[model samples]
Target: METKIQTGPVSTKAQMQTVPKKKFKVKSLLGYAAFVGPALLFFLVIQILPFLMGLYYSFTSWNGVSSAVEWVGLENYLKIFTNDPAFFNSFIFTTKFMFAAVIISNVIGFAFALMLNAALKTKNVLRTVFFLPNVIGGLLLGFIWQFIFVKGFASLGNMTGLEFFKMPWLGDETTAFWGIVIVFAWQTSGYMMVIYIAALQGVDTSLLEAAKMDGASAWTLLTKIIVPLILPAFTICLFLTISMAFKIFDLNISLTGGGPFNSTQSVAINIYQEAFQNNRYGLGTAKSILFFVVVAIFTTVQVMMTKKREVEA
Candidate 1:
């Protein structure tokens, strides 16, 4: 007569709450610290400490020999802004070189990537050959190219009887500027090509085939489909080229030595001259700090603009 009912335990809101937060285990934290502590310590000591010292020195008037380092407030900065004509010229030359190098390198690199992306018998070999230049240090590459421009060009000119190579490459200002640009492009384009090639390989062949089947022209396909998909590569390549071109030093130094009346001088050369060459470390540090700011601004603007385009794409 009596009916027995069996029922499962009712789940409450408390039972459905999130799992308890992980406890702060000192052992786990110590393990993580053991893994990351060395790199962080080295970075702080090597990079951050020097940077802090440089910041302090920028406002001083230390000749780098005497123990006397007088704080000159903004005097160093003001002098740089007003009295440093050579530095200004160097800045101008560097800016011009940067624009030329960035544009030419990216264009050539992208073209090389496209060409290599095509199925070819010697693609791998060609890729290695193209990238070989980038493996060499800029200083060595500069010295090598310097010889080519000075001796090699003259010899070839004599053999071919061509007036083009006979002209002074590193002697004249305009030619010297273009000479550095040429070298920079030659050295840097291969690196960008590698990046672009990787990006191109990641592109979906199916989408490209479908677009082709829909009667899309090559140009349309490249601009509409390919470029949009691989925009991140463009962003990375542009940033690298811009920074490299801006901070150009060893190449300019070895190739031209900022010679023929400081015509080919770059900001790095200017800073170096002010510091070690001229024994004006404080002023040099000031110039360096300002140069860093300008570079940071330029690169930041470029990345922001390109990233915006990437989002739109």
Candidate 2:
């Protein structure tokens, strides 16, 4: 029998010919560009360009209307740090509000989630009712609550003879601070509740049942098991509440007008007033840049810390 030998070069050439290398398809590239180009262009034009301009303006002394924008390097920043007491006060108020709002909203939201997680007849309706406030715009919510605080509370106080309701909710500084806190918590808790509910639903039913079988009390299960498993939800809720509280403008403006001596003025309102009201565009831009840095630092730290906890859990 004659052995048929296959030549290596011939076999290699045949294999190479059988499998063709793919060329970069201009059609596919163009298709992708068509899909993504408009959004990218819009973002550059609307966000990135404006941010760059604002950064440049921060170093200049440009009152919004003036044709003369003199370079005043570091002067705006120096003024904010050294002389701007109102801006500092706003920062302090914003910090206080952030803590209060985050805690209260998360607590209430988590509680609502737990309650709704149980088999209930009215869960759907209750969820809708709770989330209704979130759908209302912040400005509208502020105005509505302003009326409620100014008029409705007084009416309820008269009918019920309750001193708590009768107090000037938006007139006094302390009350105004707490008043904003209440409205913030009320408006935000439902949204946080929705997030918590989604997280809660993702918890393994078997694990919960196993814990119950092991005689884990509700509080113990919550603290030891449920909370640990859903730490990501906490992180998200905290981030949202922190950002909202820090950037609180419309609510503060409409509700109290940062009144009772500017005690409730938020950093956002301060920036707006500096830029628009005072026409100190350079100073406002400087403050805004500082504000952005502070917010970035805070959210970054919070996310890092919470992410560490999440991993450990």
Candidate 3:
């Protein structure tokens, strides 16, 4: 007891040695901040801030032109739910259009991809021709197609004496809906075709050759092998078309202008009319919020489903 006892357990030799800590590199941190800070700042200022503001505005009775913003709470949302048949109609039209456009566009794109995947000498030229429509601005494309549907088709109809081109492509409700779908598929398919072409090129040729050795038919090879391999491209093209079709504004506006008794009005057009034309900013924002939720759900479900397929494949 007289001998001095250690106050605590013996320390390890390594512990006795001073372990150097990582130096805080202000230079590295500054470098990271320098690169990412501007984009983060702009995103906050442009997108996030506007969205938060819109959320608050959706709860108020603020006519955009007026400085007097009355806080109306859920009145705008309640009006949309109880009194808005036009909004529902517009949503219905948009949903229908989305389905039709997605199907036709993907089909045509895949077909174009298959065509160009072959060793045709003119494939490169055709690819450019196909993708050119996608380069044309949507508003201009819509206008050009509008002229074709209204006038050029009529002239062709007269020349050919066929009822197909004679009917008012953008006049009647049924035709107007299909007219939009047609133009959308034509413009969009080319872009999707390029994606498919890229995906197709990446496919393993050995697998195809092996299938050929196994006496696999073209259809069988495509359905059983190639399609699964390229499912990601399908996912991408479908997502793009679905979003584009749902938010169709410039094209719908310039082409039909929601004509044929507003029968062809899309949800985007409805929201635009509510906000700008009707001067109901609060109600319009409410509709937009609702639209955002629905579209988000649909696209999320689609992506999840396709992702599962990719995993399985």
CA lDDT of every candidate: 0.94, 0.93, 0.93
Candidate 1 global TM-score? 0.91
lDDT of 1 by residue, 206-256 (tens): 999999999999999999999999999999999999999989999999999
Off by over 4 Å in 1: 1-28
Enumerate clash totals for all models, in the order shown. Answer: 0, 0, 0
Better of 1 and 2 by lDDT: 1
Q: Write the per-residue lDDT of candidate 3 for residues 1-313, one digit (tens) a residue.
A: 4998674555554454534222346666788799999999999999999989999999998888999999999999999999999999999999999999999999999999999999999999999999999999989999999999989999999999999999989999999999999999999999999999999999999999999999999999999999999999989988898999999998899999998999999999999999998898988999999999999999999999998999999
> 1 or 3, which is superior by lDDT?
1
Cα lDDT of candidate 3 equals 0.93
lDDT of 1: 0.94
Which runs in model 2 stand beyond 4 Å of their true positions?
1-32
In terms of lDDT, which candidate is strongest? 1
What is the per-residue lDDT of model 2 for residues 180-215, given as tens digits with 9 covering 90 to 100? Answer: 999999999999999999999999989989999999
Residue 104: error of model 1 in Å? 0.5
